[model samples]
Target: MRAPSGGNGGNAARLWPGIGGLAALVALWWLATGAGQAEGLAARFAPSATLASAAGLLRHPDLWLHLGVSLRRVLLGLAIALLAGVPLGLLVGGVRAVDAAVSPAFQFLRMISPLSWMPVVVMVLGVGDRPVLFLLAFAGLWPILLNTAAGVRQLDPRWILLARSLAATRAELLMRVVLPGVVGSVLTGLRLSIGIVWIVLVPAEMLGVNAGLGYFILDTRDRLAYSELLATVLVIGLLGFALDTLARWLHRWWVPS
Candidate 1:
């Protein structure tokens, strides 16, 4: 028989540690939930029960609708943030006057939590998806704006001078030079923004939206469905992981090491 390849061995080496950690986590969870004991509330939240509940939830069509609605909100909010943040970031980074003027106010607003605006947003937007979108956009905007500005600041002065010497128009300089240089930073900001948005999404969804993962979680709790609630939590984690992975892949693809 052929010997095992080094690549396969290395892959196994990396994979085993993650598997071991998950196994340890499961063991701890089992113990905490009374280790299969038949008569406790904690038993309802045991790993076995949660996994089973997750499986059942996966088989339900309604669950997909909730997932879709939540995902749509995330995408829309991200789009809004990107549209607003990039131009503002470019303006702030490229112009010293703009930076000096707006930086303090931006810092002040950034310090405030997105959730703090929940009541006012709901009052203004009047419930449903609008408030949730606003909250998510607010949460996601800072990272992208900050990172894009940093990218612009770090850009090579020689590149700008070269473009100007070549008689490039302002639009050409921005599109051909500035944008290409900052793509990596923009992507990094997007990754960070996705995480922030996902974290804010749950509570933001509580503001009168009828269908979403957050609403489903509330429904499950109201019905005393502990296992389903846990399952929903797992689903959220998995989805977040997927989003982060996609972001990482984009970064890797665009930015050279």
Candidate 2:
């Protein structure tokens, strides 16, 4: 019989970390809630109660409304990153002079965290999706740009030399070779950026959007509804996990070899 493919085995093995983490969380919830470590957690950790609450939230349209709003803002931000990151990366990556000129400025800006920009973003863009989206895109771009540039720089010089020798047009080389060559790095950057985006989603949405998980968090807190707050937190974690899973799947399925 033939030996098993390492690729398939590796794929199967990769899921254990998530599975292990989730299992540990559930175990801890059971332990902490059962131990009566907190005043209200015992009731909150009752799976039946939590499940019922989750079901009730699902039945209501408001939860969906909150989710939709958050999704829209995050998606809009990701789209902006894609639009601006790719070209900027290509320009900086493909040219030596351009890279040298722009690298310092980009590095300086990248060192600044998205949260640091909240005040400026709010003041400049005003309180709405614009500032939130702007921050998300801003935070997400540096990785994509840097990764894409690295990808370009790492490309086999022989390929470009061959292209020049073959008299391949500029557009043709970019379209056929450079783009495909760098897709993996681009996707890697996208994955990292999405993680950042996920972490900041609730905070961004909390900026008085009137609706979103963040708003839900504030409402629950103000009402002292810890169960609802916990539930929302759970939802955020699950959704972020889902996004990461999706990104990984896309990287495997669609990224150029």
Candidate 3:
């Protein structure tokens, strides 16, 4: 028989480690959940039970509804961040005066965790999707703004000079030169923002929202559905992984290296 190729061997090498790590994790989880021991509270969280619950949940329409709501919130928050961050970042990067005036305040606001604003946001927005959106947008904003600004700052000065020499209009310069050059950085920011938003989303949804994964989690907890809760957690992790993977794929597609 012909020998296996090096590329296939390399693929196996990369794939096996992840599989092994997951197996080890499952083994650890089994032990920690008191598997094969007398029934206890922890036993309810066994990987077997959680995985089974997750499988069942995946087949449920309500779970899909929750997933849809959560995804919609994430998208809206990202849209808000993009709409606000890009222009502000361009201003901060392209103009020294704007940078000087805005950087300190931006830095200050960025340092504050989005969760810290939850109470005030809920008070003002009054416990609905609006507060959740605000928190998510807040969480996602800084990374995008900072990355975009950095991208702009790192842009080649020669390009700007060349554009100016050609008597390019400001709009033309921004649309043709600056925006294209910063696309990679903007995507990077977007990826980072997605991660931040996903992380914050669960808790943000706890702010009296009637739908979404976060609300489902609370419902599971309130109903004493421990296995379902763990399953929901697993679902959240899987979904977050998928989102990050999609973002990375987009980045690669847009910014080939």
Write down the lDDT of every candidate, Cα atoms only. Answer: 0.94, 0.84, 0.93
Q: Let me know the TM-score candidate 2 reaches against the reference structure.
A: 0.89
lDDT, candidate 2, 79-181, per-residue tens: 8998899899999998889999999999999999888888888889888778888988987888888889999999998998998899999999999889989
**RMSD, one per candidate, in order:** 3.1, 2.5, 2.9
Candidate of highest lDDT: 1
Q: In model 1, what lDDT does residue 195 have?
A: 100
Show where candidate 1 strays beyond 4 Å. Answer: 1-12
Clashing residue pairs found in predicted model 3: none
Please give the lDDT score at residue 133 for candidate 3.
94
**Cα shift from native, residue 44, model 1 (Å):** 1.0
Question: Which structure is stronger by TM-score: 1 or 2?
Answer: 1
Superposition error at 111 for model 1 (Å): 1.3
State the lDDT at 172 in candidate 1.
99
Q: How many residue pairs clash in each candidate?
A: 0, 0, 0
* lDDT, model 2: 0.84
What TM-score would candidate 3 get against the native?
0.94
Summarize candidate 1's per-residue lDDT along 1-257 as a digit string, tens digits: 99877988897999999999989988998998888884566878999999999999999998899999999999999999999998898989999999999999999999999999999988899989999999999999999999999999999999999999999999999999999999898999999999999999998887788999999999899999999999999999999999999999999999956
